[model samples]
Target: MSVFRYTLLASVVLPAALSTVPALAQQAPFPADAGESDGADTIIVTGRVQRLYRAEQTTVGKAAEDPMNIPQSVQVINSELFTDQGARDATDIYRNISGVSFFSYAGVTFRGFRQDQSFYDGQRGNPFIGFSVPQLFNIERVEVLKGPAGLFFGPGSPGGIINYVSKTPSDTSSLRMVATGGNYDRVGISAEATGPVDADGIITYRVGGFYEAMDPYRRNTTNKAKIADGAIAIRTNEGGKLTLQATIYDNYLRANRLRGVLVDDAGNFLTDIRWNANEPTDFLHLKSQAYQARYETSVGDRVTFDAGVRYFDAREAQKYHEPRGLDPANPDLVRREFRDQIRPVHGLSFMTNATARVDLLGMEHKFQAGADWYDEKNVLDSRILRTGVTSLSLSNPVYGGAAEGDAARAALLPFTTTDTRTKRQGVYLQDQISLTRSLLLVGGVRYDHFEDKVTTSTGGAVSNRSSYRDGDVTLRTGLIFKPLPDISTYVSWSQSFEPQAAASQDANAGGPFAPVTGNQVEGGVKTQLFEGRLQANLAAYRIVRRNILQVDPSLPPVNGVDQLAPIGEVTSKGFEVDLAADITPDWVLLVNYGYNDTRITGTVAGQAITNAVGDRFANAPRHKVGFWTRYQFPVLDAAFAFGGEHVSSRISLSGQSVQPYTIFDASITKGLGFAELLLRVDNIFDKVYAASGFSAQSGHFPGEPRTFLAELRVRF
Candidate 1:
């Protein structure tokens, strides 16, 4: 079953766990329990969506029909939810996932982790969020495998990894279209079709594309993207099959980089903003193109192989005055940052899996051995625009797009800039040996070698340069026990490693790469209640990393936030729990919590190098929670959705108590013949607060007020 339908099954598991959803729904919109649909037990519950039916899953690798079960905390965003939710981009797909929030400051957030460190399919899809290009649209479903995934992914984040699955062609010939319009003048249209290439059924093809546009509250109101993707598969009579898929994406953006707000003499934060209240030519612009190619094949009955390659290119430029209060070094517009970048990535990931039955031991074994390689080349040219000192306020939210009449033009500086390119190579072997009818064992080890090199933006300069040894090995072990047909529990542990780029000063001093980092994790998972319809994965994990790297700004002259700080040592640890239930056939519920004990375990600055008595991590809140639910109106054959999301209160500017906040949302959708209609209202009642952790110049601003969207889809 697709991951989505599996999540549908997750919705069914709830009835046996909580029978009090109706009362909760009637009260607060963001009720701790989440939604109001806790009544119905007729939904036929099955396996969770481990495999989502969409364009991308086919890109990860070929899965064996009866392959050994992988022990990991995996979640899927299925297509059924896709059409129902009208998800325009990768960010929207996780609307109901708890503790997972999208931070425009960087990228998508999981628990307290950012998307920059995650993976795409099983490749090196991770990139710095602000500049990372997006490749989504005709996606199949998104797969999230939690825990230290160094073996599965390359390096960077030790928090976990996320993969986006693309769509693939099938033997069925059919076409589907989806179109929608909503608040913020948002509109989107997408079409897809699958058909057989030959009457003999040897070849098949699937093609899909989409166009979308919207106006947000950010500086640049116009946001749009266009995508085209297709896949082809060939089946042979000898029990072998091959599938290949290709995709291209285009994006257009014009938005003021909403920096932080400015605090006044009285401590009041300002909102009205502009490129430069003193300059009229400031502008923001960026456009990109991305392409992906994948291939997969299955041999005989005991072995399978999958591989893929991807490339991306973008021409991006942005001109924005550094915000006043936000930049501690200089509040005034001493200089501005103008940037241009063209980034392309080339990488390949493939694996082979085989099963063997041992007669002497009377046991069956599934052995999976695979190799992986990745490389990324980043080209950047940034120009600093200087214009002495400009006018007031970068924090004030400027709504009218005002004009500053007699302002001077910013003078351009001819300084060339550049960055170091990164590359990684890895290989692994895993074995799952089934010992008894009720027990199974899994174990594996992996090794990776990574290299980074720096260069000048203009090719006029070169250096044998700074480098570091980024090679390490890790192992994974797990045990599964199924005493009952409906009850299964497993305990698993995995190890991962990462080596960060050198510090700026070190680089300037001809410094070399830093020490390689390592993280070890262990946790137990449980899939319980009601014939496997309900699943609650409770995991207690401690991520230990050595040679921890952190930027510090505590050096005498610098007591505030610094863009240029020294790299120090640190260790972050946390715990996570997620529960999904079908509750009843007519009602569904989802709830999750994350407790991250993130601290500057070690820093050279002694007592207050990083965490002060009141200082919190940049964007992480110790406590994170989210809940969502949908209940079907049996009489109308439609579902009504409602839920609330929240983050506990925390400090923003080293001081100030910006209270904790929560927002509620609701919607309903009905399936009618070949067409389905959906209606949703977000931020119901318009509770205002920063959805992003960033607060107002004062303390906090209201989140997106009441907003709604209506959509429809058709298939033949």
Candidate 2:
């Protein structure tokens, strides 16, 4: 279906469904459940009266399991923490997670590797694609799963995965409205409501939407977004439940796809941080609609089954100017080029799983078996047109020189059109066995078959076509030993696989390459100190990636053409520490630190090409530290929060050095009966630093300067 049609249908259907539900009186707050269990009769009670910075369980493993029970490094940041901190998008919460940093728009440098894909409710497929950032209006929590997760998620980076758990329908009835205003002409409003559809509480519904508009810190840049989300749940007499959810997003960004400011060879900015190379008319736009349905039921007393299906359709387009290089005649002038691109993506995901609890021999086991399938088709059309005014001064600024309107587009030539399709299917089985009261074993194995095809055409004529099909088996095994009830020490080993391009630029020289594979060994200790008031986790790991494709340095060029080979290897070793403490009834603190070392380990031996064997990975910082603390004053009915992050120096992909920097933020919240007000200030010191860099020509992305935001929330 078209984006407009789907949006219109959802707009009509959601309100009609909600209108049928009768409103009820507000209910008192209750203990929040972490999530659904894996058919096991284990109940983990956190005993939290109010929202805390710590999370006890996660569903990233296809079930709700305590973080201590899982051997891998896992962390969760809930809605309360991000909301209190005044987070604007998903990237704003990265500081709470160890070993993570921004790579670009929606991507992150995770454990020395780049990761861009995200999961929703433990399912694969992300609606927010390309350069778009995901809004947090409908998110309940963000879960970070470190290391390889190939046992469940097929074809992914070896570093980790991020899961966005959405807010679902609840039995409690409530209405909330929020108004926000901030510096830079920022304004936003949102409303959310949830309640039961009938007096018997057999059906429930939730609907929410938000509209935001802002002019960013960058010159000639503006952002606006509108999002709508709705969900409905129906419970059967037999305890079976079905949930349906829909989301619509419309986003527009003007001159927001900037390549940052011009920089010299020494990484010094030659222009102001807010400098813009593109015209005010340049924009990036995205429109998306996603729908999902899930059904869960129990059989007998030990068996449970759940199934879900998700469909996502999105269109993303951008018109931007890119810096090519400095003019040879005049070093003070930079050459620019303009391009327009249109991308459309369609994705479908279906998953079903069953969990059974049984006692075999003298051991108790929780067994889970599942199968999942995903399919996606993405198409991109690109057009490039160069105007007479393609150079801009570095010291002085000028705008509105680029060509505009249909006349310019009509004269443009088609650069490239690429159509790519991907299909993946995997079946997995896992078992959590208890050998003794003090020892536990968790093991899983998955077999995945992946197929990818790419077709490239220029000027409506096919240029190159390539297809790849592969199947592999990945494994996960972890052993946990508990010496005390509150302390656990564990070791784990996991494997992952990712598909690579099947062909090289010279199709005849290098026809195909093998898929990349990675394995990691990790050991960690988890402790619940002071009667579960404090949670601490420490982990050390080493990951090795093989079958990496690189330019063949050992082989001479055939027909004056370079070929590619899969004979490269890389390694990443790191240690991380995360701590969360509810120091007192009115105070909470969170701290995380990460140290990583990533280097190329193996490559072809004749001559160096691209990078040396011992070179470190670009954009991977060696040290990172983050902390946040909040204290409430009961007498004043107010709370104050402070947070900061520090990142060490790093190298960019083009061999340029990146400077280290630190930034701080603060916020204050006051309670006023049924309403609450919050004031937040970010980058209080107005530190000038680069978040990341692309190249000397493109320069580095500048961090946001000092900003202020105020929000008021009312509930009824």
Candidate 3:
């Protein structure tokens, strides 16, 4: 069957499934019995259920407000949730969210847009090109705003935005220590401490750090990383504050990168056969340092102002092997070559916002204005060693073929050295009007300016220089209605733009390509059920994107890649539902489901494109589901948690099909005075599957096998 058929099936089935849940709740016997607020249950559940999948307030829109009133699809993952799940990277947390997935060379796919960029404290951060994953030890919480959020985040993927909030100092002093040892010979230690720096309570400080090393499940793979983060704040009695924060990250991975097994036509990867398609000497190193300063003060009772500045620097070096193709004479033999490269990037950002409340036309209104600017520079130095390990047999593999040393390395002087610089600026204004006692209107508009410069050199001689510039205005508006204090229903429309960094294939055209534009219309309902202990949200949305990059199929390959053109349009529509409940004081449940359908809608009339209209985007599964539940026994001072995830079949870049797969995980935790012990197991069923892959490439990444981890945590 085709993707459209499956999407149609889901569209019919999911709504029907949702309609029955409320009836089932009415007949169920648990919420009435467990909803009672006993002293014991309150003490135990308060530390667990209240913190899961919930945030009191967020600054995703430059305004702090309850997520239920945001008029969009938003999900918050606090430290407690990720800590319990043993999350280390984006993949771990995205699994619990609807309509989010990972892919190789694509970074992360949200909705139908490939998002390679993420934000820190509402500002742009370093891009993740699938080479290095960010650390989470110092993160206080993560907020994900779904759909077109360009009004606040400027140019980015239309799918949504992700913001990472760092931990800061508090009045109460606390310290925590954690030691962990897990499968794959993993062991690590981490520490976090925060306290007041002065007796008068005017100064406070916080520090957090972690170190870990492990041998991964993949053969000949080893990894190690170290991170440190610190912050300090000074406060005045008048509610004015000044803060400074800094962080350092160093990471190294010596393993087979971009190496995976080949799948059959049916998308079945042989479980017993596994080999590293790259040389054992392959490795990657990344180091970064960042600092920020922020100040906030109130001019009067109804007005406030805030400002911040941030700077970041990073360096990367890697040597790996990239796959070519299978030998024509031997289907089981795969061809590979060596790649050596280095990149150094640095950037600075400045932002400010002011908010005020006023009464006009017999109603009160809140208004906000903000502006932000960022400048970044990047340098890429690349080289190639073509004579390394060439082929590897799928059925059988042996070591000691190619060794790592300067003697075996050779530089390709013909390769171009590129230096790129980018500047982005945006100014936005927002207003919240209370139309009536239970009705509210929210709206915002942003004007953005973007420009880029590229300089290329060959063998120490300058070859070419190019510059491009563009600007756009984005808009957002929403309406929210509240029949009850805890129930909210809203509808929203938003716009987004993303500037293309590469030049167009048509040299005769005026200049670089125009930015891709996106717009979305969404409606949703959010409510607190069962006396505010259970939260449920349901949303439906449709997004249309124009000026998408497409390649001309009639033209021959250029340097093993096709020439690009920008004359494509695509549409993505989906329904999402999320539920988190403390269904009895001791029982917690989390469930999320997404039904997504994405397809190319338009292309040049006569020019053939690789992706035809009505074809689904590569690696975007139409169906995704997740379920997790936990139960705590107060008497035994213990808790048990289990969850499983499922994804439907996906289409690859080359139009190959990938079969659907599922995985399960479970964990147990016991409290011992000021310390706690946790035992967790992932991939409990030992199912063999592909986490992700490139359709046109030979890299079919195999999922990990059954693994176990044990952690001991203490607090003082």
Cα miss at 486, model 3 (Å)?
Answer: 1.0
Q: Which candidate number would show the highest TM-score if scored against the true structure? A: 2
Clashing pairs in 2: none
User: Of 2 and 3, which scores higher on TM-score?
Assistant: 2
> All candidates' TM-scores?
0.79, 0.91, 0.89
Give candidate 1 regions above 4 Å deviation.
1-69, 105-115, 125-129, 132-136, 236-239, 260-269, 272-293, 326-360, 392-411, 457-465, 502-516, 549-571, 606-616, 651-659, 672-674, 694-703
Per-prediction CA RMSD (Å): 8.3, 9.1, 7.2
**After superposition, candidate 2 runs with Cα above 4 Å error:** 1-50, 386-389, 402-411, 504-507, 556-561, 605-614
lDDT of 3: 0.75
Quickly count the clashes in candidate 3: 0
Model 3 lDDT at residue 40: 31
Q: Which candidate leads in lDDT?
A: 2
CA-RMSD of model 1: 8.3
Worst 10 residues of 2 by lDDT: 36-45
Per-candidate Cα lDDT values, in order, are 0.54, 0.81, 0.75
